[model samples]
Target: MSARPRPLLLGAGTAIAVAVTLSGCTQKASSEDGAVSVTASDSVCEVSKTELPAGHVSLALENKGSKITEVYVLFPDGRIAAERENIGPGTKATLVTELKAGDYEIACKPGMKGDGIRQKIALTGKDTAAERSPESDAAVAAYRSYVLAQAEQTLPRAQAFADAVKAGDIEKAKGLYASSRIGWERTEPVAESFGDIDPKVDVREDGLEDGQDPTTDWTGWHRLEKALWQDKKIGDRERELADQLMTDLNAWVKKVGTAEITPTSMANGAKSLLDEVARNKVTGEEERYSHTDLIDFKANLEGARRSYDLLKPIAQKNDPALAKELGQRFASLTGQLDAYRTDDGADEDSYTYTSYDMVSEAERKELSDGVNALAEPLSKLAAAVAK
Candidate 1:
């Protein structure tokens, strides 16, 4: 909504090792080894200690700014090592990560906009094999397999949707739209690593590069969604967009194959999926043209739940009660979502969802409450796994 690429509102495999930093509310200025305290104010980010021992490190971040902010640990290669979002004014959150000895940057984004103010930090220590946990490794492997499987499935679905659009088959394209987006929504974080392709393929209408010049600038699934659901036809322009989408999706399939996955990221990805549901899906802001936001919400919830499931064993090993609560919360949220199912199919995946417009205000509130309930405990999962 602000500018290009839209506003900032927004490895692998081996059972990669991870460690969780146990954190709690603390007003102390001093930090313990393997832990740092971060404070975000008007324009700058302050760290209690910039140098950390390589292994597991926890950042206890407190937002002192009036607006919501986010923090990120940028790896040397520019990949994000860890990040925590939506730390509102006066709120605190913890980020835990396992790092090999390397140079990295700490980024604090105030007001959740722009490239965040950056600060360099160093991890100085010897590589310790003892830091790697078997539980963490297995969790990472399960999540990587989940993500790779989702990406593999996305290709054929995207191709089918694109083919339908290119052929000017309105009804077929409309039906395939939501289903096609499921894979992308589930593995969105990985898809986003492809740079501009993510936006070109998935950016919503509100996120169009230049909303003023809709004819030339508007594109992606929402663009084609509008053409199929509203215009009811795909002409040269829509066809061209469809072709480009197929090209980008093909590229995404290739990219996803090599996308990195780790335990910390798996936990963060789960939280992010819920954030997507809360930020846009429940508000009816995502599916303006198709009224299909619930479809995306369901997909996102599935992604979040899948991530949690992969981390559950480790989370349970560390904190059994917390893991049990998380499972119950997910089930509760799923039950809430289940109410929206139409009788169009008997299978869970084949069931159709009611349009958001048809949902009453009370129902929406219930949905929001359900998400909040789930998020409260879901938020603790990453730390639980790490510990």
Candidate 2:
């Protein structure tokens, strides 16, 4: 998986109304217009309001913290409704997401670690169901189905990989590793929304929480990757971690049906996928052990394409120029990625690419530039769909 506290960008648009107060974490209620003004410092997370009409909400986030911060809108059950990660110190960004009428919390994690400082909030008015058009509703339903299917397919592949690891079949485990991650790389936003699963299933070594002992604390695909590739052998501990990964993935598969899915979220998630490509895949930071980053890159692009294609009807109607540009950009980036393919005849799931370690720095730069070009136009997708 891509690194945690991943950088995110929301496209420019007319700001929606939601408010956050900057005082101490005292629970207060107010409904106000304009963007939710969120100020994150080293120890404080202040929102301008604790109450708002439920629908589309935008937070104008400014990070005052000395360390990078992450902000989340979370359901009471601990499921993340939406999140903006890697908000660097002294920088500002906007997070746009849809929320149904419910009680929730807005949490700010300074340094992008641990349970964060939180403020309780409530959304008044009816659920967003009546507010959304039938077309939007259909898009959400289709996306939910897609997400569930990916989760279902992932479980069996992950089981095979885990089984190989336990059997001490090093080469078998290595072969299964990249394939097992395909469904996950394709649908990470939904998986990450669960809050607890990503850390256990996908976290990289540098992404570990504070005070976590890498030996005992880290338990995920990347951990096993390190053991198989870097350490050059699987030990008893790797076997146990492999089993634990299966348990975590089972939980993710079971929970996929219940995840909050909305048109705006699907659009935003597509942009998030591109961001994943830029931050980790382009940098060659992801899949560093196996050098299978290209596989992940392709998966992320396909996932983003899936979301955009679903919402294309609405986007084309609302903003035809943007829709056209997006299509072209997606094509351009896809062409760039296709250049690295080692097996042209292979199916999407089984296509092989040049090992990332062998990718020249100049080639990496071209890929990065292509991703950035697509990402800029892709960022506008959420607002276009919402329109």
Candidate 3:
């Protein structure tokens, strides 16, 4: 991929590629009395700058342009307070809310959602900069502790659910599985630790066969939560099936174990990635997700390796096989990365963003499909074994 964006003309089947964040904007803020106003346009959401007076100050959005606009108040912590949609131009709407001093983004268009535009509104009274307690290392530690707890609790529930379904205790298994889903949801943020099959039913991915095909549904130890809990009536078949499911699920969880993360590790990893994207140069190994891309991929692979390793101590571990498959897929990816090497034998140090155009579509698909296949088995493993 070249450093500069080349605009294609006519029908060469060409398209210009660039990061969407580099968009330009120029709009001014207007303020009158306690209310703030601005000329809204598609290009930018303009508003006043001197922070809102320290107190409960109401914001009135007056759209003077011709087109419809959406107004939103984004707090410093990335929480959206109030939003108005399809407000016609030459119309005024009031956003009755209070703002605390920090930083805020006021927007008139969803297109400019991440655009860091500020409508400095300051609320008076409390000098407290925090509505919630400040983030501490202890808090993060507690979160990790909570993840392990949730994982342990949910994995058993999931196993019980599977067993109940297999044992033909449909009602018992379904109720247990539904409760397990709540357990699984709590652990989702730390899911990368165990290769699938660890016995924790990942609510996001695995599901019981729910379509018109009855035989295909619940083929594996896991079944859809809704099917097990809400849809199916309690019966002996359900109990028997659930019991069978638990046998598989428990075995899997015992094989793979808890997810782990080092303190200050993830943040440092993110910074390394942003440093690369900041450079935005795409080439060589950097052409793909090498550098920042590679680091992220590497971290993910490390996570995969850990999960795979966790499964190593047990018999019938599905993760090792998946890990080996992933290794091969990664090897296949090396060839596609070769396209980025220039004739000069020098890889650009400024590699910030990788453009996929450097490789062929067939190659991209091949790698993507490989990753997907690897993930599918992992998902099963996690559902079957999560502990």
Best by lDDT: 2
Candidate 1 per-residue C-alpha lDDT over 280-355 given as tens digits, one digit per residue, 9 for 90 to 100: 8888877878999888888889888888888888888899999999899999999899889876556545447998
lDDT of 1: 0.74
Q: Can you write out model 2's per-residue Cα lDDT over 15-102, one digit (the tens) per residue? A: 3234444245543222244777878888998787788789888888888879988788877667778877667999987777889987
Q: Indicate the worst ten consecutive residues by lDDT in candidate 2.
A: 7-16
Tens digits of per-residue lDDT, candidate 3, 296-346, equal 233333334333333333213434555465456435433334344333425
The local lDDT score (0 to 100) that residue 302 gets in candidate 2 is: 94
TM-score of 2: 0.90
The lDDT per prediction is: 0.74, 0.84, 0.39
Global fold similarity of model 3 (TM-score): 0.27
**Location of the lowest summed lDDT over 10 successive residues in candidate 3:** 1-10
How does candidate 3 score on lDDT?
Answer: 0.39
Top candidate when judged by TM-score against the true structure: 2
Better of 2 and 3 by lDDT: 2
RMSD after CA superposition, every candidate: 5.9, 5.4, 26.0
State the lDDT at 346 in candidate 1: 65
* lDDT (Cα) of model 2: 0.84
- Where model 2 places Cα greater than 4 Å from the true spot, the runs are 5-33
